[model samples]
Structure formats: C-alpha cells, structure tokens
Target: MANPTACLLIIGNEVLSGRTRDANLQFLATRLGELGIPLREVRVIPDVEATIVATVNEVRAKYDHVFTTGGIGPTHDDITSECVAKAFGVPWVVHEETRALMAEDYARRDPPVEMNAARMRMATLPLGAVPIRCAMTSAPGFTMGNVHVMAGVPRIMQSMFEALAPSLTGGVPVVSRAVHAIGVFEGNIAEALEAIQKRHPDLDIGSYPFYRPTPGSTGFPGGGVALVSKGVSLAEVEEATAEITAMLAAMGATPIQGEPG
Candidate 1:
C-alpha cells in the first residue's frame, strides 16, 4: 500500500523569526515515517489567526492528515485553538477534560493550584474535536477533522503525537540504505545518479558530499559522497540502490553501505 500523505503546519512567531528552533517538524516527520506515513510538506507561519486558519484549511484539504504545532499556550499569541475553531466553523469552548488535566497539573506544582484565568485558557478547543493527551504537559492537544493539533514544546508534542499515533493509517514505512564514497566527489557520479533518479521517480534520491583533505591510499584525509534513496516500494528502492552502487563502482569509488563517512 502507498503511505498515507500528510502535511505539517507550524504556527508561531518564535519559530518563524528563529527565536525558537523548530524541532517539532523533524520529530513528527520521523514518527509519521515510522508509521509508514509520508510527510508531503511543512509550513512555518506566525501566530496570527488568519494565517493559521488559511494554512490549516489549505493543508487539510490537500493531505490525508494534517498536524499543527505551537501557538496553543496561555499567552496572547496562543490563538491556534481559536483559529482551528474558526476554520471548522465550530464553537471554541473550554474542554472539560483539558481543564481537568490543567487543574491537576496546577495542583501538583510547587506554588499549588491557583486556577488563574490565564492558565485555564489552555483548556479551550474546537467543538467535536477529540483531545490528544500529553503526559509531559497539562495543555491537552486536540484533533478535529483531519487536523491534529499538538503543543509547541518538543517533549509535550512528542507525547501528544504518541497518543494520536494509533489512530493513523499507514503503509509499509519507507526504508533506506545509504552508501558512502570516499576519495570521490558527487560530480564524478552526478550524471549516473540523475539517471537513476529519473528511472525511480518514486524513490527519494539524495547525494551529499563532504570536504576533506585528499588522502592517499592510506585513508588518512579524504572527502566522501553519501547517496541515500528512500521509498515505500521495496523494489524501487532496491533498484535505485543497485544503480547507485553500480555508478559509484564505475567511478572507482568504494561504496561504504549505510551512514556517510
């Protein structure tokens, strides 16, 4: 079966401006890949409601599944919940379960539970959305339609993703075997590699080259090339791998299978 296609929308000014590095994209991508789900695209946008809603609607319409991260906090920029609600034309209200979870977390904190209004804001969700729980954090994420909303924090986002994992459908996960070529540059095999890619369009073909002092036959200092091809179709991946290996051999480059260097 072909892997289910998915897209990710990362919402936050911090991530857009580099104030916060976007870790959630890679985390979710890895997790989804493990489940045989292919991530098609990823977009990072500000916390503005219009942008969030537009992106959510666009991605949700295109992919089998959509995920969002960030802007679900208690601060003013935290408008993801409301934006999602607006996108679906549903009422945004405080979900009881999330409120309970937040309340519990507040109770366990050092200062004790204050039940402040700002903290309680974390409980809001779009109507009919199913809550995706995070054991690492109090703010419960939620799923509505094809869109799954998760927290911005890495640990919290991971837990929420795990909670939602079982519900996703997937095919055989894409598996990859990389080959490294020392004492040669990518230019040496560029034409053959491009031919292989054209032959196996379904597979993801990538070539990475590292710079190092040219080593003699002793393998002291030498640059290398890394070739990686990944895909759900085992036959296609294997075929591409064989072609890549053959190309490397033609260039007299030793093919070291797996991770580069």
Candidate 2:
C-alpha cells in the first residue's frame, strides 16, 4: 500500500515575522519519514482566527494526517483550539478529564499552582477531541479528526509527537542514498541527473550545490554538488546513487559516498 501522506500547518505570527525560527517542521518531517508517513506539504500561517479555521478545514480534508503547531498555550494569543473547534463545527468547551488531570498536577506543585481562567484555557478542546499528553508540560495537545494540534515550543512539540506516534498508521518507510561530486558544478551534471530521474520516476532525485571558503585564501571558494535519490525501495535508491556516482566519475570528478563535509 502507498504510504500515508501528511501536511504540517505551522501557526504563529512570530514565525512569519522571522522573530522566532520554526524548528518543528524539520523534526516532524524526519519523524514522519521514519514512520513511513511522507510529509508532502508545509504551510506557515499567522495566528489569525479566520486563517487558522480555514487552513485547518482545508488541509484536514486534503491529507491523510494534518499536524498543526503553535497558539495552543494559555496566553491570550493562543486561539488555535477555538479556531479548530470552529473549523470542525463543534462546541469549544473545557475537556473535563484533561481539566481534572491538569488541576491535580498543578495542585501538587511546591507552591500549589492555581487553575486560573488563563490556565484553564489550556484544558479547553473541541468536542469529541482526544488529548495528547506530553512529558514536558502539564498542558496537553489534542487530536480532532485528522488534525493533531501541538505546542509551538520545539521540546514540547517533539514530546507530543512521540506520544502520538504509536497511534498513527504508516506504510513502507522511505530511504535515501547520496553521492557527492567533488569540485563539480550542478550545471555539469543537471542533464545526467534529469535522465536518471526520468529512468526512475518513482524516486526523488535532487542535486544540491555547496561552497566552502578555503582558510587564508583569496581565491574562489571550493564547492561540489550532492546528488540524492530517495524512495521506499532501498534497491532503487542504491541503483540511482550508483548511476549518479558513475555519471560524476565520467565527468572526471571524484565521487564521494555521502554528503560533502
């Protein structure tokens, strides 16, 4: 069977404004790849209610799984839960079990933390949603239909994903093989790479160029191209990688086994 497909919806004004860099996409993409769920698309939207509701409704229907990060905290700007509820056309209410759990955990604090209205907001979720518990914080993420909501913080988001990973259905895990051609430009190998890609239409073939400064040198920087082949079939990836290596060798460039240092 084909692998399950996923889309990551990153919701935060900080990310779009470049004030805070997004670290969740890479982590989620890698984890999903390991589980055989390919991350097909990623969209970074601001913390707007209408946008979040619209995006949630859109991606949830398009992909097998949709993950959203950010705006789930207790602060006033945290409105993803209600927006999701609006998107699903469900009532937004305080989830009783999650509320009780958070209350108990907070009561055990050294100072006996209070469940204020703001803090209680963290326990709110859409009707018929399942709370996702994480090791990092008392506040929980939640899953509604195909949409899995998670924290914006990298540590908390990773914890939530790990907690939720077991429940996800997957398919054949994708693998990759790379060949680095030393001192070779992508323009020199683009045609060959395209031909190889055409021959293996099921695999993803890509060529990336890199350059590094030589210490204490005024001359031009040294660089090379890294050709990568990815697919569910290990044998196909290996074959494509070998073809790329041979192509680089035929062009009189030294082909290394992996990415350039």
Candidate 3:
C-alpha cells in the first residue's frame, strides 16, 4: 500500500488576517513527515462556520487523515469543534473524559479554577471522538473519524502529536537531499535542472536562490541557488543528486552538499 496522506486545516480569523502568526503548520508538517505521513494540503480559514464545515468535509474526504488546529479555545470565535461536529453529522457536547480532566486540573490550582460556561467550553467535543491529552497541557484535543483536532499552541500540539504518533503506522519515509552552489545562478542551471527533473519525474526538484548581502557583489544578482531533490527511493535520490552535482561541476561551480541555511 502507499504512504498515508493528510490535510491540515488552520482555523482562526487571527491567522488569516495575520494578526497571529501560525506556528502549528510547520511543526505538524515536520512531525507528520517523520511519521511517514505526507501532509498534502494545508488551508488557513477564518472562524466562519460554513467555510470551516465545507473545508473539513472536503479535505477529510480526500486524505487518509485530516488535522485541524486553532479555534478550540473558550472564546466565541472558537468554533472548530462545533464546525467539525456539523461536518461529521455528530452532536457537539461536553465530553465527560475532558471534563473530568479539567476538574482535576483546576482542583489543584492555588485558587481553584472555575468550570463556568466559558471554561466548560474547553471540554466540549464531537460525539464518539477520542481525546488526545499530554503533559503539555490538560486541555484535550479530539479525534473524530479520520480528522484529528488539535491545539494551536505549538508546544501543546507537538505534545499531542507525540502521544498520538506511535499508534499510527507509516510507510517508508520520504528522503531529501539538498546541494548549494555559492557562485551559481539559477538561470544558468534552469535548463539543466529541468532536464534532470524530466528524467526523474518521480522526484521533486527545486531551485532556490540566496541573495548576497550586497547586490552584484559577485557580478551576479544573487549569491547562488540551492538545488534540492526529494523522493522516496534511495537510489533515485542518489542518482538525481549525482546528476545535479555533475551539472554544477561541469559549469565550473562546485556543488556544496546540503542546504546553505
């Protein structure tokens, strides 16, 4: 069978408006990659229920797993849990396991936390969903069907992922190799790179230029470009890497193995 695929839905008006910089996507992407699950699509949407509902339904249907972050807090703008329930045609209710955890957490506080309507909202989840909790925070995240809803906070989300990853089985991990040439220009190597890419269609090859501290310092607009090749097969990666290195050498530019930064 093929590797598992996933989609990430980032929910929040703040993230979309740039008020709050998103930190969960990259964290999740790296963790998922390590687990051998390729995260194929990522969408950042507002707090609108309809948009959330539609996006959740769409990606969940397309991928083996769906992960959503943010908007699960107590504020009115926190609407992800309800929206997910609507998407899955399940009822959103205060989950007993989560509530018990919340109770235990607050009971130990110097000034015990209150489980008011606002605070109680944190314990709510879609019916039949399982909770994901860890030392990062007691505020639980839930997994409903193929969709796993998580906290937006990087630390908490990472902890939740650690707790959940072991249960999932993954295929062979995708491998990546990057080569940087200090004095090479992408324009000079574009055609060669394109040909190499065509020859290895299964690989994902990319070129990224690094700008010099002072423009035209080396008479080149940018310092150099890094050629990166990514794929699952070890032999294919090595073959593409060798081709890229040879091409750079032929052009009188030394291919520096690995990324610049």
Highest lDDT, which number?
Answer: 2
Best-to-worst lDDT order = 2, 3, 1
Q: Pick the candidate with the highest TM-score.
A: 2
Query: Candidates' lDDT values, in order?
Result: 0.85, 0.92, 0.88
Worst 10 residues of 3 by lDDT: 213-222
Worst 10 residues of 1 by lDDT: 212-221
Predicted candidate 2 versus true structure: per-residue lDDT over 1-261, tens digit per residue: 789899999999999999999999999998999899999999999989999999999999999999999999999899999999999999999999999999999999999999999999999999999999988888999999999999999999999999999999888998998888767877878888899999999999988887776888763357777788999999999999989888888888889997656
Q: Provide TM-scores for the models.
A: 0.90, 0.97, 0.94
Clashes of each: 0, 0, 0
Estimate the TM-score for candidate 1: 0.90
Task: Give candidate 3 regions above 4 Å deviation.
Answer: 215-222
Q: Please give me the total number of clashing residue pairs in predicted model 3.
A: 0
Q: Among all windows of ten consecutive residues in candidate 2, which has the lowest summed lDDT? A: 217-226
Residue range 1-261, candidate 1, lDDT tens digits: 456889999888888788888888888888888788878899989988888888888889899999998888888889999999999999998888778878888889898978788777778889999988767777788999999999888888888999899988777887887888887767668888888999888888999887665545554247787899998878888888888888888777778878763
The number of clashing residue pairs in model 2 is: 0
Candidate 3: deviation at residue 127, Å?
0.5
